[model samples]
Target: MMLPSKTVLVFSLFLLLNGILPSTTVAAARTTIGFTYSAVPSNSPSPEHVVAALQSLNIPAVRLLNPSPTLIRAFSYSNISLLLTVPNHLVTSFADNRSSATLWLYNNVLPFHPRARISLISVGADVITAAGDSGSDPTTAIVTAMQNLHHALIDLGIRTVSVSTTFSFINVITTAFPPSSAEFQEPVNSLVIKPVLEFLEETNSSLLMNVYPYNVYKLHGEIPISFALFEEGPFNFRDDVVTGVRYHNLFDMMVDSVIAAMAVSGYENVPLILTETGWPSNDEHMNVEESKMYAERYLQGLISHLKSGLGTPLRKEGAAETYIYQLFDDENESNSRRNNSLISDGDTMQQHWGVMYNNLTMKYNIHFDNADQISTVLGLLVPSMYFLWLLYDFRLAGILLVLVYFHSRKSEGLDTKITFITCQIFTSRFISGLLIDIDDYFCAFGAAKTHVSRSAFLVSTMLIFSVA
Candidate 1:
């Protein structure tokens, strides 16, 4: 039982070398997760509470339907990334003139940037749905507004910013069952989708899509509930004749549907970010347990997908960042109004979707036992180690200075000689290659030499001219 002091010291050193020490080593890895906020219609919870709740959950981003001064101010000091959207009604006006777009950005966006961490500017909300509406030809206006806003942002030196519109049901290619052969409906694509895709491709902005697999399951009762919810079992449906891709869960099927549509429109390379996807915790027809199970499964699958760094069946290696539909269920905007059939009157489960309840208590424990140990180690070691590394590099930097001095002196003499020789050769070559006839032997010989020994001769000529 009596271990030697040296032996213990050696064991401790081994553990530290192998990264077994409980010292914090901060990794620069961060996930940009976001939630959508709607401040109008119903007085939603205050941004303070939202920010506090999201901060506690380690979420680093948020997308707002409309930018509110109160919300922006509340989150001013926080490091959360904000993606603000212009309302559907405001799109036409904003698109009509550069002045309007400039005013909007100046008033709403610029005031909060570098402080509130605003990153993306979505121009319009659900243009696909607006286009499908009976009496609204809002698509063209909205797209034009988005284009104007994008140019305005660029003019203002907002190079890292992105501008795009979000699309809902009408933009999706939902029919192809196995998921790969899915294509957008012709009428919708021709009028609204194609132009949007073209703009997104040209601007290098992501195509934001709101995909809810919960809707697919609710609408089509034939698909097994377990399969739709991503339960651990073999799916009954395995094959598709169209694209020949096998799908076990609704999420993959849904993603593949979008990919298929993008490929059809020749916009397959454009990034597709899931702007919204979440399950309602309450529904009368659907089992409450099933709703919870679906939510848990969906989040787990999403986290795994992000960590895996893989894309859907169609885009097997592309950016696949997603934003879960909401942070909390909006009772006023749920079910009938938003076509969210997952919420119901009798069950209070909709309100329970809050990872932290109204009282700010965590709904369920997110198991981070494995990460906790790593986090602890990282917290203790990274800062000290980084400083030590910096100091060590700084002390050795004199070597770089000495090397530069010698290099400069050596280059001086050779450079002048190179310059003279290179200038003479360049002048001779130019005269032969351009002014002299191809029939002349000297011109033909010069052209042949230039073509055959192009790379080597150019390098030599440049060095000679520079030295001379």
Candidate 2:
């Protein structure tokens, strides 16, 4: 006995509901949190010290500026994940020969794979550095090097590894105001950006960027410090052009700027990870207590946004992973000169920024266990909700179709009914034709024939209506 078409469709829908829906729900129940650790320079602090501090804080992942032996050794026995970096100077050498990349990985990464927990490698630091800086336009070289490195890592049987590069201040899009009008500079897009975007998309690597809202506020003093710090104060100004998008915070605006840049570059789906974002407590430019307040507020605001599980204004469904800038203040680098680097001008203020200062004392304690639990719950709920939504939509469409059929049947004898039915069928055929044309165009661009055949069926339906 064969089942009717309607019965088969219902059964197919039931199978989708039971199998595909539940699987998608389960898959969506995971969340990732990561941090960047560039402050722990090669000789400044022991990797063991850093790892111990991170472990005490319950940090699960960290990004390193360079994968030094000390750092790797320190993280060897820990479950903390590492994202290692390839410095800018070595990029050109790797680009010269792909084999060199393989050798570099063998020496730097391969040996410590499982133990060190190095999950990702950034091929080079900031491709878009200040113009006229030493070897500023290394985008092509860096991207090629990254590709080669990725291939090498894959060949070495490192399945979890990824290759990509990070960007800096120069990469922030022009016209970043209003957040919607953001786009990369024309020169950077042509020279250093397009290829890197392609490579990142191909390799499935996050677009790591060092975002500092403090600098934006410092540079443009017109914007309120309260807004920059995500304090609960009224917006400084509301945009006249895009109503309702008030200038309340710099971080959201800056993120939207990156989102806009990605949209213009046609790589909108690429993940935007905040590789560095923090404030210095003792900078000459800002007050010490204010800096600490700003840092705390900025972090709290960012974590709240991530917990909300919504994308930015421009990209409402994008990745919201963020990594705070530094674990501790380094005495080596000249922090005062560079506006970006935050250092405690005095000893006491410096101690305030670190969760565990130089004396191994914990400061400003916030429970991570509660936050992690919330993240886990969201990880489960979001995917489950999405799958259920898909099932609901499918069921709703079926019910609507049934209602439309019965309504049409009841009104068949009326003249207005005949015209309405005719118009509905006509509109359906026109839409079907358009869909068929789109499918053919996609097929021409190398879409699979299986997909194209579905388009062909839509075309056939349109032809049958046209003849009738």
Candidate 3:
């Protein structure tokens, strides 16, 4: 279907803004959804009020992209899980000096861990990714900073906090179709992706992927909107001949693309966590009704999908732990049109990527409790000793292991599930080169059998062990 013309689109926008149109979303099962909390002025809510607001809204977790003690303090004593960030520009200094990392933690996270629910420390932003940040490959800087800061966290006895970094999906994925055929491009794959995956594997950390299906639909109009929205799609299904997995939504495809890329790169069991994903809205670009519909449908669908515990088509046992792109809009950033280089729609959207207005008013319709309340056990991951290498905290992984172990045992017999999950997902050579008894694990498995069943056990095993 061709997109609506400018006239109709404009009229629609007008009506929605005038409140003639309403934003509506279907009910969906709850999932763990957080939002990006950009810094606001001190006393804007006096920190205490902001924390109260977040709790009252039932926000499960929050990712603070910018370093804001005030915001962190606001979340302190609140139940919300906090994912703090390290600026990209600081990657160099943090990587170079252990003291720099320590100092950062002392200020940002030391005073607040269990109290603030400091869950993860993202190493850097994607802003510096395009040119490698300050002339050095920012990915490398990220790796180093993550390693050192992890040590700092450990030294500080902050065991619950994991270290990770964000990567743009477009930067890593080379092909997305047919799902199974996905792989990462060179230089990025070898230089960035491979190392990053290895670091995550060793650390028992997830590759924080920032995916924007909204951008995909906007840029590639041929793709169905439902594909991006996580809603029941117009296509409904796309099959991968090799994987034999049928994809119902664009999110699983995009996510599994990274999984496939990791599998191809010899690190089959690398885990994933979503650091950013959301739709945008603005009066000039789209109407309030349209904007509300975008958030409602997309989020409701995503919440239901995640809570289904079906995982993705490819990794049935793995769940996506996702954080929404933003809470409230940033006025200054939104207003900056970059000298009017962007077209009308793009300009409108540029400043309007928020669930609420910067003034803390709801821009669209959504229930805070449904989007928050983070403990949604949608899927369990297979264990890998190597995957668990750098992570000293094994409680979370241990729980998943037990759940998946029992789940597997109840179904396809223990031997096959554990063996396949561990070895099949591993690269051919890695499996071909394991120290254990291969036949005892594989039995008389025919080529006809699919390989996802036992991957959990093996990945968990790798996660437990540290690789040199």
Candidate 4:
């Protein structure tokens, strides 16, 4: 592996140039992204403030593992879509008695529905393998609870509120190499996952999966850091030996591995909604810079990929939504029941996944929405240095070009109009275009159906100049 600092520097430069470039395709935007608000509310942000901040961020969706009265009140009458989760313990509660699902809705959904944008009710958060689950047959319990809830929602004419569950990627997926070769291991797949897939298929709801490339990369150092951070990883590009499908990043690999598992289970077509993914701002060692960059690149590259409509190799142009794992650091320990990480309890990293300090200070220096990401204080320094180097080289080249132009004008008496046009074509059109114009990147990467999209980016920027 390359030195991490050098790799990070190169990655930042890549983002800077990528952003500065003009694109023929509609520029990538924040299309399928949301926040998984911390399960138990944090000490700060008063539930009200959390909702208010979303409004200012121009974000219209948030997922809550457990509902809060204050959150309901704040979300009520607003345009924000809420994905409320049913706790694991309650899975058996509703399973023990199906009719109780109706009561569950009355208490949770009825109070905040069309008015508060309560769009989805995730059955439970990672109940299948959650450490403390008491249910012997989690699959049966979770399915029964979902069926009951679905019936109750349909009876109440709330067809929009879909039902599903959130699952983590650790200890569940046995192998995820080459994506097409991926599959789930025994018991977990047969006992729980298969039935859940059938239920979600019947209900036409997307599966909620938690994928943390940070954890995968941290634990398995074999994976490149760039791949973990969502940067274009040359080392990660691989073609599946079995199915011949290519995968680029660990994020897509993890997601498609579940899709592969589904195919192995005799179920092949179920969409996924990423319910949790975020990097901590610090760990026991307080590595804030590395932590913040991890958050920055991972989120930025994901936003671009989704906005590009380039789904995983399995579904090239499909849809997927990713909710950042957490909104605030759980300083009060509201949702630390499962630390999933191998770190000791003393390591604050498990709880410090917020993109900022609870006080709203930019911990990752992150920007939400369509704004250019990766302009963070740390990210900007590398590009600023690279720009100076480029300026020096560019000045040297400009002097030579000027010397030739003036020599020609004085000695050869070149036609003034011809000289000016020649200069404009070279300096204004081709060179500038070379610096920041990408046409049909999909074809550039050499994917299938290249001819179909090859020329769509042909509208040379001459059109922009003429119109302006």
Please list the C-alpha lDDT of all candidates, in the order they appear. Answer: 0.61, 0.62, 0.62, 0.65
lDDT tens digits, residues 308-388, model 3? Answer: 546776676444468876766665553222211123454553545667654566666665444234322211111232233
- The TM-score, computed over Cα atoms with residue i paired to residue i, of candidate 3 is 0.67
lDDT at 2, model 3: 20
Which portions of model 2 show Cα errors greater than 4 Å? 1-31, 39-45, 135-139, 236-248, 283-290, 318-320, 335-355, 365-468
Estimate, for each residue in 100-127, the C-alpha lDDT of model 2 and write its tens digit.
Answer: 8988888878778888888778877664
Residue 280 local lDDT, model 1: 57
Estimate candidate 2's RMSD in Å.
9.9
Model 3 spans > 4 angstroms off = 1-31, 40-46, 127-136, 284-290, 334-349, 368-468
lDDT of 1 by residue, 108-215 (tens): 877777788877788776755554453767756877888889888888877777888887643456474756667888777876778888998998888887777776
Q: How do all models score by TM-score? A: 0.66, 0.68, 0.67, 0.68
The residue pairs that clash in candidate 2, if any, are: 29-379, 311-316
Error of 1 at 115 (Å): 1.8
Please identify which of the two predictions, 1 or 4, would achieve the higher TM-score against the true structure: 4
The runs of at least 3 residues in candidate 4 whose Cα sits more than 4 Å from the true structure, single-residue gaps closed, are: 1-31, 39-42, 131-137, 233-236, 283-290, 332-339, 342-351, 370-468
Ranking by TM-score: 4, 2, 3, 1
Task: Give candidates' CA RMSD values in order.
Answer: 17.6, 9.9, 20.1, 13.5
lDDT of model number 1? 0.61
